[model samples]
Target: MPDDARDLDAEVRYAASPDVAWVEGPDRVALVDLRDPASATPQLCPEPAASLWRAVAEGPKGESQLVALANDVVGEQAEALVAAFLEALAGAGLVVAT
Candidate 1:
């Protein structure tokens, strides 16, 4: 989902597709496919979410601006949700923090 197109909160709340992949068992971590409206999984769970974290860690944007961006479409819980999603990815070895 593009940030500019739809409200994150609204998208998560109403527009998200019903399909999500749970990749676990053989690996310690898991991969979840957050399907887009087009049904293509463009994000690789933690890696992309890690990129988001890198963006935050770099301090490129003020917390307010960043949080607003996180909240832009994701609402208040977006912060934690992104983190949990990333952690799940990391646990599966799909992504590693640099």
Candidate 2:
């Protein structure tokens, strides 16, 4: 793993809150949050976010493992990107960090 994959926090898992629902389209996946009826943040994730979510779909995963997986799929800079995506997912209550 690259140095950028270091200093990661706890493991995270895909956690779908009741407030949000997952929607899968022909070409992409999306999340619909019921918290705000009018405003919807696009859940159409790119690259490692989609892959990372798939990784943790079965269970929780450490940041390092996730980064490694993303790195394998998306190549360079995947660690930083996956970390950031995980943070956003956690913040949105779509994932749980433990």
Candidate 3:
């Protein structure tokens, strides 16, 4: 976890790269990033994570900007929420921060 919000670059974009595919079923929206069809498991982004994915798809944005955009969905904890969301996505190798 980053001690400072600025430690997280706001210019990073969520790269739903070509290697990943988006699937929207009646009950869910998931991103399938399979490193190997026979080995790596696909990751599922539910609710806010799914929402965040959609937002990042618009373009590269900073943490503050993401929080601001997600304010209605998250309320006062927007900053923390956005940061955590980005962290999780990055950790999953679903997004790249640069």
Candidate 4:
């Protein structure tokens, strides 16, 4: 387990990549590649956006754990940013905590 994983409250599961991310009750998926923006169809965002979405889709993995993961996958200063991102996703009906 990682340092922050030690103190988490909610269940957590790892995905393959951020591109495969999708909200599913208390869990989320992630993909490796970002979807092409120019395509005239639905597109997936890249990390750290995808990573943040994964967190929200997956539900609270404990704020601390999220902060750590965000720092690692996104950036050290992105913990708060990712938290806010998750909030926005939740607001947009794109993510829901179980």
Candidate 5:
């Protein structure tokens, strides 16, 4: 894992970015960064990603809690799944460290 991933795993708490506009659909969730016009095009998230998004959106949650939540959705893949999701959300400015 990269240093950032390791640091995230070490106890970073995260929550959905206030700048993100969220819309939930029947099968997927759409996210757009209100602060970034380039991201006016929504990013549609499916399945586990949507689940993780909803969880973080509710409130700040630590890495372990997120991994456990992912475990409920993806079994043994929880750790990697969470890491990837967090990285993607952070990169997209859809999630922020709290």
Candidate 6:
């Protein structure tokens, strides 16, 4: 996890990284980091990750909003799931805190 991941909270807002290029499929989403040509392979984002990705791509959202969006999918685990997702996204350079 990055230092920023430790700072995540209900009020922390996130948005998709400008360097990412994404394609949304019916079942999943694929992403490529344009900033790293050598590793710019498309990464598949499944399920809640895909949904969350789409949501953040639209605009910045706080941790609370993401948890709400993920609630239907993960139930009681929504908060932890969203937090883990945000941490991974931040570490992967796919999303940034704003």
Could you say which candidate leads in TM-score? 5
Angstrom error at residue 61, model 2: 1.2
Q: Candidate 1 or 2, higher lDDT?
A: 2
Model 6 score (lDDT): 0.87
- Cα displacement (angstroms), candidate 6, residue 68, comes to 0.7
Against the hidden reference, what TM-scores do the models get? 0.31, 0.64, 0.70, 0.47, 0.84, 0.83
lDDT of 2 by residue, 1-93 (tens): 655444443334344455666666554567677778689775775544777766665466777778788788778988887779777877777
lDDT of 1: 0.42
Residue 46's lDDT within candidate 6 is 89
| Poorly placed runs, candidate 5 (over 4 Å) | 1-10
- Stretches of candidate 4 off by over 4 Å are 1-7, 10-43, 55-60
Look at candidate 1 and give me any clashing residue pairs: 8-73, 9-73, 29-91, 29-92
Give the Cα-based TM-score of candidate 4 against the true structure.
0.47
User: What is each predicted model's overall lDDT from 0 to 1?
Assistant: 0.42, 0.67, 0.68, 0.51, 0.88, 0.87
Which residue pairs clash within candidate 6?
Answer: none
Query: Candidate 1's error at 59, in angstroms?
Result: 15
What candidate 2 gets wrong by more than 4 Å, as runs, is 1-19, 34-42
Candidate 6 lDDT at 76 equals: 90
The 10-residue segment of model 3 with minimum total lDDT is 9-18
Q: Which 10 residues in a row give candidate 2 its minimum summed lDDT?
A: 7-16
lDDT of 4 by residue, 1-98 (tens): 88545545344432223333343232333322334434423335455666666654455455565677778865767767656756655454344444
